[model samples]
Target chain A: MGRIKLMGLAVSIGKVTERYPFAPVEVPDDYRGKPVIDPGICTGCGACASACPPQAIQVKEEGEFRVVHLFLGRCIFCGRCQDVCPEGAIRLTTEFELATPNHDDLHQFVRLRMVRCVRCGRPFDTYRHLVRSLREVPFIEGERLLLCPECRAKAPLDWLEGGGDGNEG
Target chain B: MGRSTLEGRFRVIDVSPDEVAEVVRELFEDGCYYATGMGVDERPLNGRFAVYHAINCPKRGVYVILRLTAPENRPSVPSITPVLRGAEWAEREAHDMVGVTFENHPNLERLILPEDWPDGVYPLRKDFPYNRKMAGTEGTAGVRGERHDEATMSVPLGPYHPLLHEPEYFELYVREDRIVGADYRGFHVHRGMEKLAESRMTLNQIPFLAERICGICGCTHSAAYCQAVEEAAGVEVPERALYIRSLMLEVERIHSHLLWFGVACHLLGFDSGFMHFWRAREYVMDIAELITGNRKTYGINLVGGVRRDLSGEKIQKTLKLLELAEGESREVIDNVVGMKELIARMEGVGVLRRKDAREIGVVGPVARASGIDTDVRRDHPYAAYGDLDFKVPVYRGCDVLSRFLVRVDETFESFSLVRQILENLPDGEIINEEYSLPYMEFGLGSTEAPRGEDVHMVLTGGENQVYRWHPRAPTYNNLPAVPLMLEGEDVADAPIIIASIDPCFSCTDHVSIVDAGSGRVLWRGPLLEGVERLRR
Candidate 1:
């Protein structure tokens, strides 16, 4: 009983240590270090919507499943989405190294996508950088952003007036 | 014999460690800043780790690589900490992760690992587990004693105790109000990231891993990894990809320095400057979002080329973001300089004399502020940096204020570089076909991370599996210098002085106490002499 009491005191007083900085830090087991998305398994479900306190989740429904977006800045790193994940698709690892001046960078969700142009039948957006170029104006609000497919086909109307695309001419 | 940079020329020499040490001593005597700590690996043919302890002479740069072998059976080396005071932390880290124990390393406690770890488990060991959470296994960070001094009643700075903004630990050896020694306990946030990159991950997985190294220099980490891998495979990043890499790097620099400025402001108790600095940083983050679909991880960096491109519209938005962010940043900096308390507090505190900084081999803003004119971007041209012409800022004052001024100056340089990369984005593919999953190649990657230079060395091996991989982050190297910087300083100057070294500190706690309660024999904890021999 005395040992137990002392152990309790030590625990409360932060007297114990762990393989910290080595592995398994003095963090809660549920501590969400960074959000990792297995692009292969993620169904793009928007289940993480309410889970995010920062409302960093962004999900766009293409055809069947809703795409999820996460802004790390807004993300409280609660890993509420990982906890709420029905598919068990998201897991939070102890990866807290997320520093950047760009807000868009903090919103990165670990996901994979098949590249396709908006206007053509070709798969030109193999790399996400190409897609990022088109995301400047965003198709929302009728912004003149040139999306992948429309920008390559050389149609002015298909792309937003000024997004990086072939329709600039 | 090798030539010392202090003599005013780039001198390359072929010599052993004995010769190298003599040359280094010669250069140190002449007063040159130790630029950066770099480690590289050569494997398959023969497993050897080549380490570089660089120095920046006033007009010339000093870089020397010493190749050593930490055979899988016996990974150890003679400690240079006795000779080079700056090498204290880096050497300990080299021992911790790579399992290279420096002989006679005065106090070779596990620098990065927490005290409650198991023994013979170097987290950075090439053979160490990356993501494999083997239940009931031990870590090398088995520290036995404490990070505090028994005399002064050691106070652990942070694992998240609030006096600091980052996760770093310092063992303050205090004698009254003054600090006798400050030992850095870091790498608490060790993700086994490099090991993950080398073993389980593909080249494509590196950008993500790179981003995890430090939030402050995400782009630089990814860019350097990309550049190193590309160079190893002899793959040319598309011209557009190069431009994008530059853009990301500059944007990253702007955000990082601004963040530092805010932290500095906060440290000085200047709340208004702190808020304003972050407010300016927000605009930069907005621009980052505008260019990259997601904000921080950009995902723009790929193996061969950038994943993202900038169109004229995005470019225009960039122009707006740059104009707004830079303008706001300028105003905030102006306010910061005008703050009397901040200026006074920072001026002479943490004075790493131009002479001492040169010997310790520090890097980035600290080096520049101390009058060492060496920037990897300028010396070793990688990516688009070869084209851009910017003056490397150097201030003669080797103090906290000098580092602050240097970072502020760098913010402007970053803005200008962004504008340059944006305006002159070449017309070519952002990514090339050569970027096919690199399967078999020995590649080296190095980039100037925000804190300093981040270098990753990779050797492609059998079955898409890396035979050997080595990663060197700026923090792993710079952590050692902090203790030395803290020695002979007052405890009151602790916060700003620590900020001067610019540690990510996310993985370290300042106070380390042995849990005599938890009886698990940590490797670093109790170097019990030949317990195995006793068992036998």
Candidate 2:
């Protein structure tokens, strides 16, 4: 009798398994899958790199550009990079079919052009990052923003005291 | 008292090495049980190595932690295995991981590390690098089979068996069809997570690392770890966050229990029941994915609170799914209980008496099944468990049937608890990001995992890192009782008896039997097949 009832229940529940490769399964809207970075809005500040638990996201300086690399192989899909992104650039999409034969396919690199300091002639900050900073602090001169943080700090006090020109310095 | 946390719910006491046994014994006499013990290399902090024993005192509703520090030059402490048998594995683990000597500990050999691992180099020490790789010593690997008496035949269950989900070795000494003695050597999948958490992972990042401890009950570990850090840092998590946490934990419990039921049914040769139980479990998984964005490893827990919030729509959907899950789970479990043949297989088999249960310090369904009324959720409530009303179902049968029945009842209880949490969820912020980390402050966080009580101990270090983080999975406490359960039982029932405790080995690995007297391989195949051959 119990077996009869179990058979009835099984008949009612029929099949729960899905044909994954043959059929497309719909994931929820908030499904945490592979995280991708929107290069246009990314400021190359390395917040995601620091916030990532597995150190999957790495930021490195390569001569003229600051490259933010997100390796899919090491990613735990924790979606922490999305949480800590100041610019809301990194987003976790519902695309989780991330298998690949080529090793390079796992790497997602976003390269931002680095701006050289006017005085020191060394790349310091990304151009977009400096521009974004300029928007927040409008009182600071654009020329002052052009100089790297080190060059700006080392500059004399008279340069800031002067109203418009460098003549006073 | 050294320090207290969570409104004096957890108290730390400093004790000298000689008094360790006496103090633990006194606590045991006062109705306390050994939760877990850890050895920490505290030379960077106090120029001494420390050993902490966390004892759960249920009557007082407080966790009493006894701390004993040994000087760096001679790091040794009196072993508490004399007072409590449950402390044996933990003491041996401490010795293996941190190079701390447990004086007078019977059979204090290497427990966690492999035999090939080089001696005198402790991985958990401050001087050791997290990513450092050591060369495996020559010719130290392979089986060190202990020969039993000629009367009893030695049958090995695992290092990998199809019956087991993970890699574990159990040598059962059988006399014809009945078993006399058993021995276990596990920890094949130990990933050195504590070392990684202390060295590389920061405060918030360790939650994800903790979640990876067990694939089935990862959220519980993460929740325990987060609670430990929150207690250490004195972070006040919002009320609504607590409710959501409780909701997710209950969801995890329901799914985990269902999974275990399916496994048990499979072991009992009831494959149809296994399929049905897992089919019902899909609803709970769907609910989890809808809320936490994943079926397992919810990844919702953070240090201050949770990362995700439950919306009204999501809550309604979750409730609908919960209804379906509850109904189907009830239908399946009720059918399973009514089957007399299945009941016969489980009943009067794998008997672990109440006294043995308490002495071994088992927790969760196994302890409850054995008449030990202990649940960390009720005793020392963390998250929203304090606000929720639930009955801890216990059975005195002290057999495999009791364990199954306990889980069945607990599954229904979890369903009701989830409903309560979802309905009464407080409306406010989900996270409280404002908190400060106190350096070198000890905190203990415990959660009643599906298997048993999962404990995580944390010592907050400067620069957003834990100085020493030790997580004791429920299996660590419960695995010791398997040999006792296997003794004097039918050798064919060995797989079900071992599976009855819900040993979550966290990795897959294989088993063979060797002749004890002749030192020859008797059988080398799946444990079930070996059992069949032995029966014939």
Candidate 3:
């Protein structure tokens, strides 16, 4: 019950604090920073896609190929996307410095990749490898297919005409 | 004794594990919700496995726990997951720890252990040796296992990694920063509480183990565990102990919410808010340390009664402190809520639709944010919450911001609740004389921890030792949502987004994510392997 308002007295009860902007605040050793993507090794499995609550990364796996398209604007920078990531392809960069003139520019990332297929413009993938030995959906044209390089070259018009990204019509 | 008035709604019907499916289905027909169930390890004694199923009827507002026991020779039962979706992880935990095989459980893969774990060595079974083995050398020690898909990649998160204070490892499937898939393996800080409780500790000594389970939610865990022991041991807490227990629970709520606010600020790149909230948090910590000897771990909870007393002076101090926190924290929280840019960034970002929250059974603020109204404190009140006046803060935004808002609002509500309890502080002996120790009994205790509902299932052996103690923290139930929520999100939002759920990494470990049962890494060698070949 022995307390008084600090403002009433000339001497403050506590030390005066310094401004953060005028000084470089010390970052902890374990500070979570920017995200880094390894283009060469990224599998585009979309665990980052799933782990990321923000839906910031678009990973399309049509067949053998996987495409990883990361947009940073939607990022909460939680590091679960990084932690849950099975491969070390994605690393949170030490740079947390993110700012941009345009909203879209804030979506910049360190990398993007297309795996397995070509003509469909999705990730490159082989259907046989995707569904190995599992006899579920049969018939090539009856079901959909990921266009390999040769198939894309053979029927460029047909592949490009009605072709949409996988999971798309 | 307060008899459950909802007895007409939920009559305790004894059902076997096999009958659990049919019994629970019938309950669902009666409009009962599947609250929670647990798998317990009962080995050496009868060499049997036990699984408990619980159901709740909101109209009646009561809960019932049903027990299932299977002999250790072939511990298997019909799966209830098909009937109740929430049963999936519970069954997996049963299989992972207690070694109960849920028959017809689709995707019956190990949910915690890595693929390479030595076969048939269940950890929680009472007879599993209590000594530590080699860490990295023995396959029994580490969670990593063989893989399939020919694309094996090991991405460790922590024992000391950036972006996390807890130690855990998540193996990743990567073509790049976009993690195609992952396996979460934790237990980096396995304090060996279970072994210590059963083998080394007595009935009186086990509450310390409960307190050590989590520093922040000490009262909740210890309270639940102790209540279970008290119920099993036939010990009755006095009405005054019950009221004081409720008071501590609300104080814990305030403390947890404040800590969460600080963590949330730290995640959103708001340093000032983080510092200010933590500074505010120091007051509550001071209050707790004053009441319970420890600063972080408050060991005030005891079975059948409280270890300390709350006099008029202590109650007045607590009331004044709550009032002080409420006045100061309101302005700071309002300023935080008014951070338009930060709020906008979190709004509608990281949405876990209501359907997924229920379907996957995400608990606490995460589920409440998504409009899933399931709180143990509210649905089935145990403490003063049953008697107190408070509203469950909920929002339908289902985003990171809504989660933040829920905690912030809940903080103020908790502060007010604390004041109300302190002002009307009941006076009586904190301990009940008749309930010091009765006989063998088992009780299920639930307290909403800082993160979510912490459920502790306990079976006691009267005065000798605890038969079994299973503490299922809210984080255990919420872990499955990570893979579901992380889908289609950017690599950048990894930190703040993961922090949004207010994750308790200590509670969960890696469950294997083998590519179609194949344990092969398709694309191996160094980073230069494929790239160098392409260049050549």
Candidate 4:
């Protein structure tokens, strides 16, 4: 009968279910799970924030700080942040046991100090981000990087006329 | 007056509003069936509204899309439902979502929106913000329960039934244990995904959202969406990427079919069969996780090509897993076919004739079982399916058993497809990023999902966003046939009959309230009693 064969198959397969809670389960090396950012290497460039589909990672300017917020609650585990991270600062670790009782536990805020514009005296780019940019493009004058994007765009016409050796600091 | 070709798979034709029905009727007569319909707000483009009806011409191996536009002030178009019955729900949906009026539609009620949703304020319009929250109106569109005089007893199946996986309300009018008429009301978990995709999500991000449309066959949605974008932008996906996409799709089919078999067995009270089938299905899931990192939502598809490539070692391991999955699945299915009790339960129950199947426009195994002989993979091949060889099993029984056998045959076919894809995968780049998006171009992408033909329509916009993106799942087309299948069938057979379509209600939000002539409530409970009666 079909029942006898099914019974035989069942007996042969034995217990297929895993003892997950009582015993540790092994996941594949390429498992996409909880994405964490290495704040030490991160330059607060906000590339991951712009690349995130769910907006789980967001960059905001808070007074003198550029805050990159990563909310685990809204994360769909797509690993897109890791893909777009310029400095390899974000990595999706195989740590998917992210259930929590407190809402604050799900949030990770990486706050970087912002650099003030030389002319406007307003918070412009993050200090580390500007430094990283300067490192990448070393030919650009550091004094130009000190000014905000708005101030840099509208620099003195006299400086443009004397472009050969204007003001080097 | 203009005609154009979209990626060589779709032929687009623009028609006036009056000739829309006639053209769709002529196409229907010419061996073409309704695939899907979409309504777009084109006020921003050319100061008019547009409606698109996509029909599949199996004989020609192309999908002919009939497009018609109406003036901004009078956005009205002729209804094609009178000619092709399958266009009923789709036209009503367009009316509800985009504020387009389908003149002479039989029942153009609120198909997608909730009863409390205010009228005349369409959520998919150009002006409506994606995150806008409107207060529920007082009795705007209340449920109209028509009292049929013939049926004496009214039996309500769900809004939440033990048998159903998702929330759906089905009202069955029964007279002395024989069902007379049935009505369905669903769409509880709409989530406003289309609105969100058009308004907020960019080109690449929509693929992730599309993958979440159906929990079981999420990859097919993502594949279809990516294909639509690729077609619009004319991106040349590498040969290796195509093979990988097909391989992953077959793997997904194997797991989805096995899952359906387990659920079917559980519904039939054969718990042992259910457990064994699920046990066998684990191998396919393992293979998916090994390849795509995640098991269910294999988030590998993007606009140009796939995100991951199959290395030699991974391909070897996948073949091993496929061997195990195919062997175990064949053993269980062979045993299941020989079981008289299980066969008797499904044999002649819930019969849907070939005529009704065509009129309803069913797809996948359901249509194949009814002898319609249509498969999107063969008729209009996509995602490396053109190079693969497989058989689409069809049965003329037009019953539940036929459907089961069709899927059984398909599971084996999928195994062969996986092997072919892995062995013949070309060496090249996995993803291509060199393509530019054209403004206001239409594209269609379709995949033969486990349930049926899953179609996604995309209208490309500037700034990396879709002007309108409509995804029509297989369940949307197949669910309309359930009421007809339930009619004249025994009350006890309702559960399996509905499940026979492999109905993914979440993929469908998609139904039930029973009203008698006297408007009296008789039985309000699960259909466990009917199953108990049948068991006795």
Candidate 5:
């Protein structure tokens, strides 16, 4: 009697398993899988690098360019990069089967040109980052916008010390 | 007077090194269970090494933290293990990580680190390099295998057993097919996570690292860490965010309990029950993916609020899945309970008395099953638990069956909680934007993880980094109770009894191994076959 009842219940429940690989996998709407980066919008600001818990997304400066490296192995797929991205360039898409033979294949990189400081002639940040900043906040523009943080802050102080009005700049 | 954090949840008391044991003794006599103890190298900040013992007074609904300071040159404090049996592992861990010496500790050996690791270098100290690559040591320098003894036979279980996914060594001393004594050596999965949190990550980054501490209850750990930081910073989370957190927590709980149930069934040799339970568990996993994005480690938590918001459609979808899960789980549990063979195996096996459980300081279903009525969600309300009403299931059976039943009941309770949280979720921002924590602030946060109470203590540091963050996983408090549970059980019932605790080694870096002193290696290969031979 017990065996019959269990079988009846099991039959009534029906099949609840999903067929994947054979069929296209079903993921939720906002499923955080592999993060896709749009190089066009990516400024190489290193916000994602700072925000990433595992240090998976790394922003490395190579002389004149900033390289944004995303190591898929280290990513816990938390979507914090999406939340913290100022430019909305990085988004987690529904593509999570990230297995690869080579270790380097797990890494995704985006390179951006470095923005040199106008006053000091040193590479300070990415050019796209400066452009994005200029477009977002227009109040701090003109000569000061082209300079790095150190040069920008010092430019006004230098003008003041050179017997010129600070407002002249 | 020291600064107070977590509002009134934790009371900090700072003392000199000599007075450490005295203070802990008083707290223990006053009925406080040792929650966790740690040593911190404060040489850079205060030119002294500090040791903290967090004692939870459940009855008073408060945690009393005993902090002691020893001079940098001689970092020594009196051990509380002599008085409180639960402080044994915590003190040894402190000794291993921070190089702090506990004067009267019975065994002051390396608890977390490999025995071959160089002495006088502590990984957790401020000046130690976080990412320094070192050469691997040759051979197992300190693999303490059990030596031969006359009357009793030693049975070795793991360092790598089929029963466990992670590495843990357990030596069980059995005499004529009955376990007399059990010894455990673990911490294989310790990836220096706390050190990584301190040096490599910012405040925003730590949550993700915290989540990965245990793949099973990753969200709960992240939530607990976030709550600790939020408390320290006095960040008032939105009601909607709190509700969302509660909902996700419930969803995670249901899935975890079901996962444990399936695993328990497999251990009991009930393959069909395991398959059915896992099938039902898929629905809860679907709900989690729908709400928080991923199935397992739902990365929805941030310091102040959740990263994801629940929409009306998401809520409706979750409700449907949760209902399905509840129905299926109920059917499966009812059938399993009615089975005479299953009941007989679980009913009186691995019996843990209420008095022994309280003394050993077991938590979650293990404690509840033993008739010690303590649930962190109800006792110390966090998230949206204060707003919601739920029963803390208590069973006095004090056996494996009672533990199983407690988890089964919790699954249904969690289903109702998910429904209530969705219905009552307030309208507001999910993540708080305008909260800043000053340096030197301390806070204690405790969340009732599916296994038990998981507490995180945070000391906010400079440059948006935490100075000291200690995450006490539920298994840390519960694993100590296993040996006591295994005291007089049949040798064949060892696997099921150990699995009854629902141990998550990744969450705790915890494990057990049983070895017989006879020349034969019991754990040579194929654990199931080895157990079968032993059974015969």
Candidate 6:
């Protein structure tokens, strides 16, 4: 009797299984899949790089350039990068099938121009990062704003000696 | 039971290493199920190591935490397995990871680490580097299990068996057809999660790490972790955030139950039932994807709030999916329950009596299948579960059928819960902006996963990183009950009996086996080979 009912139920809910590759299944609106980074808006500020739990996104300094790399193979698609991106540069698309023939295809890299410190004259952060930071922060302004964190710390000591003339907030 | 006021999440009783057994023995007599034990290397803060044994005294509505301190140089403590049998694996795991030797432990061999892992270098110790790579050859000489007599033959069931989805080695001692004794060795997927959480990741990043602890019950772990940090830092999660967490938890429960039901059907050789259940479960996956943006490991849980919000239309869509899922699930379960062959195989096959269930400290449906009624959601409420109304199904059959029924009932209950949470969804900010994590504070958070209670203990540290983080998955407390259930049962019934516990080996994937006599290496699982390959 139960087997008969089961057969009837199976026939009623006929062909519910999806046929993928041949017929495309509709993904929901909020389906998080592959991460899409808006390179145009990305400032290379390293917020997403730092916020990534798996360290899939990283800012590596290579000689004169700072490269923001996203290793898709290691990415869990948690969207922490999307959540932490201050510039709204990262978003998760509904395209999850990211398996590639080459390992290089798995890596998404963006190279940014390195900005040199004002006092030390050594390359520190990305040029876009420095520019964005200067514009965002109220205290950082003028040429002193272009200084690296180390030089910025010493500039305050220099300001005490100069009676806060040039580097005043 | 001895009464103690609740201090945060647990009623902690500071005891000497000698008194640990006695206190735990008293709690056991007073009807407390042993939850889990954890070891912490507090040498940097207190110059001593600490071992904590957690007790779930739900009858008295309190969690008793047993704390014992050992000198840093000579870290050793008495084993609580003699008094409370469930502490067997947790204690061995503590010994393996933290090197806090359990003095009277019968098999204090390596539980998690490889056989050739260097001595005196405990992974959980503060001095050990998080990313340190250790080199070892394949199948190096390790602790050979107990030597068996001529009467019993030791048969290896895993490390690589078709019955198990993940790698876990179990040495089954048998006389012809009947099974006599069993020994387990797992922990293939340790991944050094705690060490990574402490040394490398910040507080915000640990949730993602917690989510990956188990593929099925990932949200439970992440939610427990977030709640632990919130409790430690005294962050009051917003009402809307709490509601969303509860909603997601129920959604996860629905999908997990469906998945388990499908697997159980497959194990029973009812492939049609399995297929239909899985087909019904896809709707749940669809609902999950609609809400949290991922089918599995829905990473919406953060410390203060959820990352995503549910809109009105999404709620409507989820309700429709829930109805469809519930209807299909009922049809499948009805058919399965009426099937006499499956019922005959399952009923009274693997009977874990109420007394033995409490003694072994089984949790979730396994414990509920027996007469020991306990649900963390009801006993100790977290998130928005307290406000929600639901029934925790309990069965007295003490068999595999009862375990199956408990989950089937739970599926319907979870559906109602999701509907309730969606209908009464609060309107406000999801993330609490004023929440700040403090330094040098401890908090415990437990969420009732689809299997059982998954507890996370967190001690806050400086530089926005956790000092110590311990995640005790439900399978840790439940797996010990397997050998007990396997005893006296037929070898044919071994797979179903083990699967009856809904064992998530990856979540509780640390093991080592023991033979009856003159210990010898009987079998090594795929874990050793995988680790060896990774190193090479």
- lDDT agreement with native, every candidate: 0.60, 0.84, 0.62, 0.83, 0.79, 0.80
Tell me the lDDT of model 6 at A89: 89
Candidate 4: deviation at residue B133, Å? 1.3
Model 2 residue A49 lDDT?
A: 94
- lDDT per residue for candidate 3 within B119-194, as digits (tens), equals 6777677767667452432544443333424443334333432333556555444434454455566555555466
Candidates 4 and 5 compared: the better one by lDDT is: 4
Which model, 3 or 5, shows the larger DockQ?
5
| Model 6 spans with C-alpha error above 4 angstroms | A137-140, A156-169, B1-7, B137-151, B510-536
- Give per-residue lDDT, candidate 5, residue B57: 82
lDDT of 5 by residue, B1-536 (tens): 11112357888888776766777777767767788877788888889998888888877888888888889888888888887778888898988889889888988878898866777778888888999765555524664535436767677777654354556667777777788878777787687878878877889888877777776777788888998898888888877888888888888898888887877777777766777888888888888888888787778888888888878888888888888889888888888777788788998889899877766678899989999888878877788888898999999999999999999889889988988888887887887867787797878888889889888888898678999988988888888788778878888788888888887765785211211111122122333333322321
TM-score per candidate? 0.65, 0.93, 0.67, 0.94, 0.91, 0.91
Note the DockQ of each predicted structure. 0.02, 0.71, 0.01, 0.76, 0.57, 0.71
Model 3 chain B weakest 10-residue run by lDDT:
B510-519
- Counted clashes in each candidate structure: 57, 5, 80, 11, 15, 13
> What DockQ would you assign to candidate 1?
0.02
Residue-level lDDT tens digits of model 6 in B264-301: 77777776787788888888988888999878888989
Which candidate do you rate higher for lDDT, 2 or 6?
Answer: 2
Report the lDDT tens digits of candidate 3 across residue range A1-169: 0012212221332443547568764432324456767865565556677555446777655443455667877664545466567667787655656786777655543333334444446554433333421233344432344555455545644534554433211
Question: In candidate 6 chain B, what residue range of length 10 has the lowest lDDT sum?
Answer: B512-521
Q: What is the Cα-based lDDT of residue A72 in candidate 5?
A: 91
TM-score, candidate number 3: 0.67
In Å, residue B425's CA in model 4 sits off its true spot by 1.1
Tens-digit lDDT track for model 2 on B1-536? 11112556689999987777888889999989999988999897689998889999988989999998999889988899988988998898889889999888987988878898988989889899999999988625645445456666777777664454356788787788688888888877777888888888899999998887877788898999988988888788888888888888889999889988988888888878988988889899899999999888899999878899998999899989988899888888889898898999999899999988888899888999999898988888888888789998989999999999999989999999999998898888888887788999998888999888989999999698989898888888888888899989998788889889987765210011211112121122355444422331
